[model samples]
Target: MIDLRSDTVTRPTEAMLESMREATFGDDSRDGDATVQKLEALAAERTGKETGAFMPSGTMANLVAMLAHANRGGEVLLEDGSHTLNAELGGIAGVAGLFYRGIHGKRGAMDPDALREAIRPVTRYHMGTALVWMENTHNRSGGAVLPLAHMQAVYGLAREKGVPVHLDGARIFNAAISLGCAASEISQYSDSVCFCVSKGLSAPVGSVLCGGAAFIERARAYRRMVGGNMRQAGPLAAAGIVALETMVDRLVEDHQTAKRLAEGLTRTDASLCDPKDVETNLVRVDVRKSGRRAAQWSADLKSKGVLVAPADLYALRFVTHRHISAPDVDAAVGAFAELWKKS
Candidate 1:
């Protein structure tokens, strides 16, 4: 199947599988796992953090980061389109007992003045803002990359108010590729960052949350509290290590392929998505103009051996990853073209 549903659908490479098989293992929850330890250390260094911890999913990573950063009754500042806000199933409020102030950003970037205004003053009646969260390569924005300067401005504004900043950087590498910079440079703007190795990197599992030593220690405890205390996680770590080492640079190819896909969609009269709007691996198609609901179109595409996902009632999303080649992009466009012609 040509699975454009999400980058999460990417499979592990043969080398990753081999490393997983040969990985040295040890009890993680009890004693420690050397491979997982190495993975955490490497992840921290890459993101320019003092330490790191492993999690089963990016949601848990973000949750733990928030749990560590904010008090139960405090608040978190969130971008309106953040995955943690709209997609994380309310773990911030439900699990962590924290409320969020949503600041709608322009192209997934919050205005600095808006951020300053949203921060509640210290008072008896109001919940004080404790953590500020940001998402880079925002999913809901069709994977738009947050510019480094934009992030720095937010960071500066947050610092003035003494609020800690956490980045839900699940697709940080994609943003890094787009910006032509190291992921660490993007990570430097926040106090904590969580990144997935499973998505575009094509690892089988795992995400890493990196931060200062104290923050990571608290996050590690939070992970254990949430049943993320692991055992013999070396196999997962092995693949993650390979993903970090071998798979980062090739994301340029995925970006190019996504552009190709967008161009193809623009050529087809039925599509409402502008090819110019596509910046990275994700392309959002507005299908309402085509007289079909986004979900219906997604299902129809899936039936025709090309998978996609709905972004909203009017829009569907296509994400390119290592598993999706340039040829696959053309095939997917062809499927859409055929379906549109019939309609």
Candidate 2:
């Protein structure tokens, strides 16, 4: 079956598996693993940060970053649709005791002007702002890439008030490819950044959180507290290294495939999806107009040997990755057309 459900469905490549098999191993919890250390340093340098720590998942990486940057009861400013606000199981508020002000922004990015106003002062009545959060190639916005200028504007405002900025950069590499810039160019505005190797990068597992040296040290402590510290994790890091080395440049192909799929959807039924909304590797189809719930459409399509995810009651999300070729995209589009006709 062609699984467009998510990029997380991608299996590791032969090269990635080979690296994992041949990787040098040591205890990572005690910082004795040479391979994990190398992956962290490379991730740090790639994102223009002083240091980085590898974590089991993007959620843990984000949680550690929040714990390190903000105190209990502090506030964080972020977009309403961000992964921190919508996903991550409310760890920022529940686990970290940090209140987040979710600002409504177009295409899943917080507005700079809104950010300036939302930052709280040292008022006894309100929890003051400790962090500003940004998401690039935002997931909830159909993979819309936040422009560097927009990030710079928000970062400038946060810096003026001495507030630290954290980026939920799970898809930052995709954003870089979309915007024709390096991921570091997008990450430079934030004090801390996290990106997943398991997502579009197609590594079997792992995410890296990067920031200042002291901040990374603190995050590592939180990582241990959250039960995220792992020993002998070099095999995973070895695949991550292979992903970074070989997978990134091919992301543009995934983007092109997604665009092709979106265009095909318009051919099936323009109201099923708007090709204009296709950005990066995510194509969010609006199922509301078809008088069918997103889950129903997802199930119907899956029976046709094409799998997709129901992001909400009204929207279905399809993601292109290393496993999904151009032919798979066309077949998925054809399945959608068949489903719509039966409706």
Show model 1 residue runs off by greater than 4 Å.
none
lDDT of each: 0.90, 0.91
Q: TM-score for each prediction? A: 0.97, 0.98
Candidate 1: count the clashes: 0
lDDT of 1 by residue, 123-207 (tens): 8998789998899989898889888999999998888889999999999999998999999999999999999999999998899
lDDT of 2 by residue, 202-256 (tens): 8999999999999999999999999998899999999999988889999999999
Off by over 4 Å in 2: none
